[model samples]
Target chain A: MPEQPVPRTGASGVIHDLGYRPYDGPRNGSGTIASALFLSGFRNAFGLGRSGKSKVLPFLLLALNLLPAVIIVGAMTLFNANELPLGYARYASATQILVSIFVAAQAPVLFSRDLRHGSIALYLARPLSSAAYAVARWAALLAATLVFLLVPIVALYVGAVLAELDFSEQTEEAAKAALLAVLLALMLTGISGLIASVSVRRGFAVVATIAVLLLGNGVVTAVQGISDEQGELRVGEVAGLFSPYSLYRGGTSALTDELFLTPPTGAVMTAAYFAVMVLVGIAGLAGIVLRYRRIAGR
Target chain B: MEQVIRTRGLTKDYGSVLALDDLSLDIGPGITGLVGANGAGKSTLIKVLLGLVPPSSGEATVLGLDVIRDAAAIRARVGYLPEHDCLPPDVSASDFVVHLGMMSGLPRVAARERAAEVLRHVGLAEERYRPMGGYSTGMKQRAKLAQALAHDPRLVLLDEPTNGLDPAARDDMLGLVQRVGQDFGFSVLVTSHLLGELERVSDNVVILDSGRLLRASQTRDFLDATGTLLVEVIGADAQTRMGHALAAAGVPVQARGGLLALDPAPELGLDVHDLIRDTAFDLGVGLVRIQADHRRIEDVFADA
Candidate 1:
């Protein structure tokens, strides 16, 4: 950074006045403010504008998340496989833990730090309203999470096309996976963001988010696995509704031709899964807005 | 002058506790000081002005805009430095201020330029690129002030700008605040529990006590000469000798904190200044100083 001109000092060693230039430029409204906040929050999720230590965790997780896709692509190219080995939608399911960890680790960075450090007051004291602040942050996290979910899928899609696979089929599958990723990103951002906002403590927020995303998914997966063994498909399908990852899986199974251990069967079950998942996501975002409103009011 | 802030019967009641009680006041431009002890509703009043907290039974207008109806407009034109810590630890002060400047609706280039200017004004030019997590309390406070000023609002409300600072740093912060209001052409409403600090920079002073307005007047009024002279003599038992001599000489002199205090009475037909000088000379003591004692903001609370 270039050095700013130091205030001149006089004979008595007193600092002279460096004129404070008033801003006579055009100022944008709240919409611009909210978009600026959204962009900043998006950068914060991956530690782009933060300290060196903060960058380590998010990038490490991103690298870990992308590793499997790279290995699968290499294997496909080396073997000259006629079919794409990994399903685009199934890739997220296979790497669900990485996604869960990323969301759990990063949600607090976006949602909790401001509240925890009392910096939310600075933001609220601006032209932006508390609800707008919350929504902007939520949208930023949604965008970042979408990036995380889409990168591997895009990598795989590129690999499939490069390896002489059917372009249209690959495009159709990637588009479907992208749609499911949006839905999944919406729900994940909401759940983790809400938990981080309410909990305040970063560690507790991370643990709670992981519990809601990973542990809940694990239990549901176990129940689904057991029900599959018992030929009780309905029990497994209903249990899948309890976790975001399971909801994503049910979404993937319903929207795409991907096979699942216990997929929600029929049009009604699939529609119900989609509705509940979207509702939960909306509710979480609402909770975050309400939480910030309360803080701003205080 | 038009009122920068006008509050009419402004009351903020938190169940079982009243933060502000039927307060009515009009504050014009220049640096006005809000004085109150802890829990004296100083913070509450700022919050209400900023529209972060709503008044329960009254109304307020900041910059002639209704606090409720035009809160967004008020916020756009008014800056606020919250009493609490508000800087993010991880981000550099430059980045944080620019981001907040944008959040205040400044364009990107304007935000960046304004952030740098304000940071420099607050004496954080070199350290602006450093993460605030490593900053000293004074540096953090400066950074906070920088962000508040980044958008060049017409008015800035600073809550206890000198809080948690050593005497030197506190003086620097107060100096910065004074320049912000006077040289920079921004109206300021700064709050402090330390009455003396505000008296130096504030054009007007508003004192609050137990959720009620204790006093609101020009800083000069709170600091008006109380018609008493403080006498300080440099000698052995100077205060005792002066007290006895003044009392014997028909002057009602009282010793207070190593100084003799006396009120001049016309009826006595004695030149008080000459008497003090003569007494000190006769006693072989050096007259260190003699000056009028002024009433401080603390005296307002005492009088109340």
Candidate 2:
């Protein structure tokens, strides 16, 4: 083997040739690749490993999201209320603008940047399939959204515990809220990730996601208000099915003490609400996979 | 000879375009240059070999693994550096390579070690920690090369490794590729449209034209000296004088870029080298040198 001298910097610097050693060690399979992608993608959503400037938006949104929860806890202690002021399930519903903005702003960080920069080609060239890449990215977004939704619930639970509220009641409500948060996170990740993946431009993706989420919610809220005024309970409930937030509200109202303006009342409507939620989530995930498969094929 | 890549009438067709048209090849282990112009199906062939694109018909195998049925297995053993930009701008080369090494099945710690080694091998050790967005074109290509080698595969397919580099950097990159094949014990199938760039590094050459196999041969065969001599002389008007004198003496003489081309006539049994020497001595000019003219890869393309 030829020894090429390494470039010298300082006089004290030492160099070694350590000739190339072939790696015959054991290698993990596609499962490991997908998991690594998931881990990296999860960190990226919160701007971890990214520039400090990039970290500001997601974290600022999180701080704002938690601000109301902290105040509710403080207010509960000061007023000596018999119970927590915000129901566990209703916390996300009331402060959903922050949640919507968080998912909208961060989804592109995980999805749009890779496709825009053509780095997804690197992942597809590995042992991992394009479907696995899409699924891993969606999983990362879902996990991040879950963290966003769960932090406030935990804070509220701590506050309620210290306030000496009924332990069993608070536990059940927190558990139910946790379950609903999972479902909500699934749907949010699916929708936002799909939008971000479809549009390669980051700014365009963020705006489109915000439009789909907030515009859809705004129109549904208007319909629910008019329908409630008209005393058409069926119209209001059906309009609630049109938006993800409304669906979550309908679920919490049906399953918790919090009341929504138009909750899915009957067994049939309630089942449809839950079914649609899961279906949209699944469909959005499937769309992202198909999109990536097309890119890989090209 | 054991083959590193083999294809039996492989073909790929997009309804409007046929990317690979009935190409059959046997590429043995070593450094082989896949040469073609932009639309000559080099990238398509690399994709098929890596199992990213399935063939419309026929068969191909890499490292003896079927391209269709055992695509994932083939991918595990073969590394690919795509022709286009494939790096994430925000991630450092170290992190990107380490992550890709893990993606190739190495555990985290092993991946890190391998990444460091490969980055240094590619001469990116000093700049490995900087974000790729701030990298020079040469640095970016080196980082890409580092990731491809991080997994230590048996074969590496490099698509235009020196695409945007200046001449000096291109020379360095080609030298590294030669080392990868000779010193590092990896079979390489590198592609380039520039004909002469691969001549110095490749053991064999394959030329493609409009999705068709144009030629494949040993690089030495393409560079073999033909039965002609290139004569150079010193002094003003010496070349014109030599051309006239040779032609007058019934030798087929031509001027090729300031060098006098002499096709000796064996029928007359004239010693052309001796004649040129005496002519130069008689003309009061100096004979610089007389050497055989060898064909270049560019000549092969021009002949086609």
Candidate 3:
């Protein structure tokens, strides 16, 4: 066998053989679709499915949210079989509030890690555009948050059906609760994910997410509480469009069988609020992605 | 004759700080060494080529695709090994590489196979299944290299691959890097601040200082000799006496190590062999070694 040549370390050998070539494999679909799907898979594989540390708190929050539903059923079955409690709806409302808080707190970790670690550089070097990167990250956050919000809500609905015992009535009530939970979860996840993407630091992202979730509601509540007018339309319906928590509260209230506060006068206003809030959240997320891309480039 | 990465007046700014100055460069394939001190914008240039960061000014193309317009296309074909420790602590090297490979468009089965092959190649097969958090610095660097190669990219951008490693580990990593570019035929752009080290492995060297190109040339040119003789011998007061002897004999000599370094003086028509042998015979000292001192590129830079 011929003796192999030793590898050259200096530039003389390298300059003549600048061996870079463009990839000639399957182009696929302009990269956006593939990148989005990959990001989704990455988030799913790692976020909810991988670690005990990541999953525990979210699951615990879900369990806490469902605690009231379990308590309500237990009280009706084991304690009071005749009439429902005076403030049964209020306990359900509290569940929505708790889920909102949990989602807001966790969303920052999803967006901040990629930026801090420079892994985002690796991803962008692929055929994925900044827009696609943003969408994928946002999708991951939404999906993870949805897992936290949906599981307990579904458990509560199933528990509610078993508690009712009357098959026909149970089916109708369970369907209604499921629909309400899905809508609430979507609103919460979208808003939290948007807030989280606004900054690269986890601390800032978390603070911004929580501010949108809690302060937005507080502002609306303060406006409603001080107003002396009768049938004054709660800003929670309109201003809630600015915050995920408010949107969830308003949507849940609308879906409930009992009318806790007078229903917003028009369904159109509620629909408009949801639509506007979602668009704003998405736009905010887009801004964040563009800013990050610029920063990373530098 | 293909340019893997070409840039024209590429610039990047961070607030008031210019991270990358107006840089015009042509990066061809194979293992091209990018050498610069810390804060010379090596990382910035790599990030821009990857299309992770948009330039403040100028244009660049990687793998024949416009860096800005065809970023995703470029990224899909390129692999990157970052300088810092960024692996997820909870995931095993095999799992992470496989996941990244799949994300780059390989099917699940293919990704797994590629991940196994890459991990084995990087000498991490025994520990591939272990979580990265427990890995030593060498192991972590190997794991990072494994992930970058897992997708079977056409080119790899390695940022200080030998960073945070012992001398033996650094040599091993450099050897692996050379193999990846030569044996596997993938183009590599590897960065380092240690010029001499890269001169041992890189075929081409691009030197940068303060975000400006100092020199870009073949490694041989940088290490070529300037025709100066270095003489070493064993005796009492070797360098000092030899220097005095050479000076008295009308030859210029400088004391270096255990040797008397002689500058090339054309006018004297000096015979280095005769002079050394005669000096050793007269002094009754054994001659050890006498050879020309090959000037390194860094030495040239220092002279400049």
Candidate 4:
């Protein structure tokens, strides 16, 4: 190695005065800002723009969610089955934990990171108001979570169609699956977005999301087991409303009572369940927006 | 000159602690230096002007927008560089600045273009692609300044841009700030606790003491020469000999603060300066620099 000259510790540096010009060009409004934030948030949810380590959990959970559908579709083709035993909605319910894990891992990437790093200040100080910023983030998380939860269901439908199954039944089930997927997205985004916004640490937000979705379901199930049915409403069905993921699954199962082993929750009871779930989800979502509004632009 | 900022009875409090107290003042358009010790309402004033914090009582306006009723509008036109470390560690500077630019209502293409221009203006160049976590304090400050300019704001509030920088880096940052306000034509409100750091860069100075306004005026006003003259003679014993002769001449002279002072009274004669010059020559001492010795800007805070 060549020896370097001893450098002066303190010396003056010259910088040319290449001043900046003011921007007089056309500028977009809050809608465009929100859209930009949405796109950025969506990419962040999947760790697309982040380091390799950040992508690990999101991709791993996504692959895990799809692997079961691939196996089921392959088995159906191999066995010359005319109908799928696992319906699309039931398939999502059966693998609800993977979808929940995806939400847990990715929601923090969208919500907790900016809050933790204090970059929310930069966001709020722009044309984007706190409410708009919150909505954009929620939309991104919702869209990403929906894609994660519904892609396998789509794959299931496509596989069944390619395998020469009953096309009419498959199409009907696909529509039902799409509706359920949207509901599941709403529930996950509302709850996970709330958790991530409040818990600024990514690890803590992820753990909180998982605990709320999974452990909360377990607690509700235990409660239902202890409580004897009071009337026509089943204890298990009523208890599922208390947890978001179970609520989605239970609602889907009730809607497709003929296709599954679980007894149908009456139409009225199911509507009430949905009403309660939406209110709860909306409350948590409102909390996320309020959390940002309180500190937004500060 | 247009008034860039105005505050009337702007009081802010946090429970029992008062951050700003009845701070009524108007700042004209130029580079205004905000000086105060820590906890002296410097940051609070900036926050109030930016509409980030609501005043407990009072009215304020920035760029013709009310601080309360038009906070969103005020924020739209105002750029703020917070005092604390607010950069995210994961993202590169280019990505971060572009994201902020888009937030400021610039389209994606325009944000990208403006981000590049401002980053170059701040001297970041190719280093803009590097993650901000690895940047030095000076580099990080420049990155912050670049984002502030990303939206082409009418005015910028920079809270201690020279904080935690070395001497050379501080000078560079100060020079950049001066040129930005002067050449770039952006009204600037820069804050520092160091008394005279903004002397060369700022056109106006506003000093705050313990949550109250101490002084606010043109920088040169506080530093203007007092009518008295300071005469410095060359030699080891020059000051002493000059002092004695001037005292004998009854010119009301004394060695005050290392300079021989002469009262510039009219009755002394029109050529009192010439008399002093003659006295220095007769005493066989060379007269060096004879000039007005003005009171330093720090003198105002010395009492406070």
Top DockQ hit: 1
lDDT of 2 by residue, A1-298 (tens): 9999998688666676878999988899888778988998899899997888889999999999899889999999999888988899999998898999999999999899988888777777788888988999999999999999999999999999998999999999999999999989989999999999999998898898888888999999999989989999899999999899999999898899798788888899999889988988998999999989888888
Which digits, one per residue and each the tens of the lDDT, describe model 3 over residues A114-142? 66655665555556566666767666655
Q: Supply the TM-score for candidate 1.
A: 0.94
Clashes of each: 0, 0, 24, 0
Model 1 chain A lDDT-worst window of ten:
A9-18
> Candidate 1 or 4, higher DockQ?
1
Docking class of 1: medium
lDDT of 3 by residue, B51-71 (tens): 777899999998999988987
Measured on C-alpha atoms, candidate 2 has an lDDT of 0.91
**Candidate 1: residue pairs that collide:** none
Which residue pairs in candidate 4 have backbone atoms (N, alpha carbon, C) closer than 3 angstroms, thus clashing? none
DockQ of each: 0.76, 0.67, 0.26, 0.45
- How many clashes in candidate 1? 0
Q: lDDT, candidate 4, residue B31?
A: 95
Question: Which regions of candidate 2 are displaced past 4 Å?
Answer: A1-16, B245-250, B268-271, B274-284
Off by over 4 Å in 4: A1-18, A224-233, A258-264, B13-15, B227-291
Docking class for candidate 2 = medium
Instruction: Give each model's whole-structure lDDT.
Output: 0.91, 0.91, 0.71, 0.83
Q: Candidate 2 on B1-304: residue-level lDDT in tens?
A: 8899999999999889999999999999999999999999999999999888999999999999999898888888888898899888888999999988998889999999999999989999667998999999999999999989999999999999999999999999999999999999999999999989999999999999988999999999999988899999875498888788878888898888878888757876878778888888887777889999888999997788
Report the Cα RMSD per candidate: 5.0, 3.9, 6.9, 7.3
Which runs of model 3 end up more than 4 angstroms from their true locations? A1-49, A67-92, A156-182, A198-211, A215-219, A222-243, A253-256, B9-22, B55-58, B125-127, B163-169, B245-250, B267-270
